[model samples]
Target: MDPEVIGAIIGVLATLGGVILAFYLANRLTLNDSMDSKSGWRKELMNIASKDEITLADIYRIRASVRYYPYPYSETNQLSFRWMSSLIINLCDEYFVETYRDKHVASYKCSNSSNFQPNVTISPENDEIVRIICRYLLKYHWEARQKMQIFRRGRDLMNIDDDEPSEDVARIIQLILEQVDKINSSSPQNIFQISAADQLKDILNTAFKKLTITTRRYLSK
Candidate 1:
């Protein structure tokens, strides 16, 4: 072969090898680094509870923000988990405060000659709030307790019941499945590979119904 032709062939081969090496390095670096794996409910739970007081309007705004940005892009994606955990914390806070805030009591005090005036004394301190706050604090601890319970049960059943995996998992799974279906129409059909996952999703949908039924039954009982 001519010298010029030989040099040109060598140059093309070197360029192809560089491209292949670059592709391999990219794949190696990207291994096991999925957006889902970095999501931790505890981190988000901390963020939610970091605030002392949260209002219903705050919850609504957080929820709306989450609904707006449905994808995870490192900094931007954490909004979903933070929003959900904050919502839970807010809801539990409201429930505790409403149920345990105070109870009205009526009393009468006698003054001289057949005259009595009603007197009321509000509790000096909200012990119930303190107790309920302790309970909320316990919920923060309960997240770890639940995980320990599962760990004790064994790692073999990591996703045994599916049950949304965690708040973060539930959020990302929806995004993943929606994208999957968008890319391939048949993807939806394959979503049922895990029966527990399906059941878990159904449970989430009817959670309110279950709450209502249980409340009614308890009232009857």
Candidate 2:
């Protein structure tokens, strides 16, 4: 082999090795940065979870109005009922479990109302939502039963300031109980742990409709 030709071949080989090394380093850097970003995201998720707690204070306030107003006659009562319905919908949006946090985090936009608008792209597994819903249902039933007993016994409710409102609340309570019972019974708790908030809402809405119809019929009687 000619000496110059051999030297030129060696130079080319060195350049190729240098390029391979550079690419390897760049790939490693990119991978490390991605991992770092993912780690940061995980931390942010934990922070959010720690900060958010679901409360039913708003529902209680609405319930108070139902206790004092008769039927749908009062504008305030009607408004409160609508607000209560919206509160449940809003609560469902706000209390999504861990899996939904990632996508929700990306698309969340704050508004003047400070309302939580869950991202459409976010879908969480059902158990978390279902558990919360079940808990709510249990409370609703217990409260409703207590109120119904009071109404049936013709006992004056101690804290009730208005008789008509007490009757309305009692009616609403009976309706809610009937609906919750129907739903709770139809969808056995073991029917595949709740996988999404929508599923829970479906169970609630279906049962609630039936309950409302039954209650209205009784009211007419």
Candidate 3:
């Protein structure tokens, strides 16, 4: 063989090998970064959900953090998202149930209003908290739909429990939706306006008590 031809063939093989190695390394790095990002997201979600007393603000923050997490591509990531959403929904449902059972049930009268009302005074701050709670409920409903779709498609690999939203959950969502409409109608410009504060507070407090009972009953079933 000619020396020049031999050298040319050696150079071409070396170049091809380098390209293949580079592509492999790049793919490995991408997979690692994706796994890391997903791990961080799971950690944050668990930390929030595991709190002794998770609040609406905490849930809102968790939901916001979820947006920053990478989009769900793998079955693992999809299952994680579905389970996280379920955890959040259950936490909020339990909180409302406990609140109603402990604080508002005694004062509630069937004739006056079918819903329970928390003992807390109606104020602008409380009203704002209620608004946030409504937003959280809506977000939970949306997540529930997403999770159901995942289950329907059998996309998640984990053996997760049933992700169906209970009748009580649906009822509470409807109550909140109604309350939101009332709040919005009363003050189109600003839901948190002082003028509608009293009405808004009453509506929210009633729904909270009703949701609490509804959740408790569902759990007993």
| Candidate-wise lDDT, in order | 0.36, 0.40, 0.44
lDDT of 1 by residue, 112-141 (tens): 434553322211122222223333433534
Please list all clashing residue pairs in model 2, or write none if there are none. 67-165, 68-165, 69-165, 125-195, 126-194, 126-195, 126-196, 127-194
lDDT of 2 by residue, 133-182 (tens): 33443344335334422233454332122222223433444454444444
What ranking emerges by lDDT with the best candidate at the front? 3, 2, 1
Q: How high a TM-score does candidate 2 get?
A: 0.20
Q: What TM-score, to 2 decimals, does candidate 3 have?
A: 0.24
TM-score of candidate 1 to 2 decimals = 0.20
Question: By TM-score, who's the top model here?
Answer: 3
Would you estimate the TM-scores of all the predictions?
0.20, 0.20, 0.24
Q: Which residues of candidate 3, in runs, are more than 4 Å off?
A: 1-59, 62-162, 187-221
* Residue 84 error, candidate 3, Å: 11
What is candidate 3's lDDT per residue for 50-167, written digit by digit as tens?
4444444454454455333432222222123343344334333433333334334445543376554434223233333344444444445345434422123544322223333354
Best by lDDT: 3
Q: Go through the candidates in order and give the C-alpha RMSD of each one to the true structure.
A: 20.4, 25.8, 16.8
lDDT of 2 at 146: 41
The model with the greater lDDT, 1 or 2, is 2
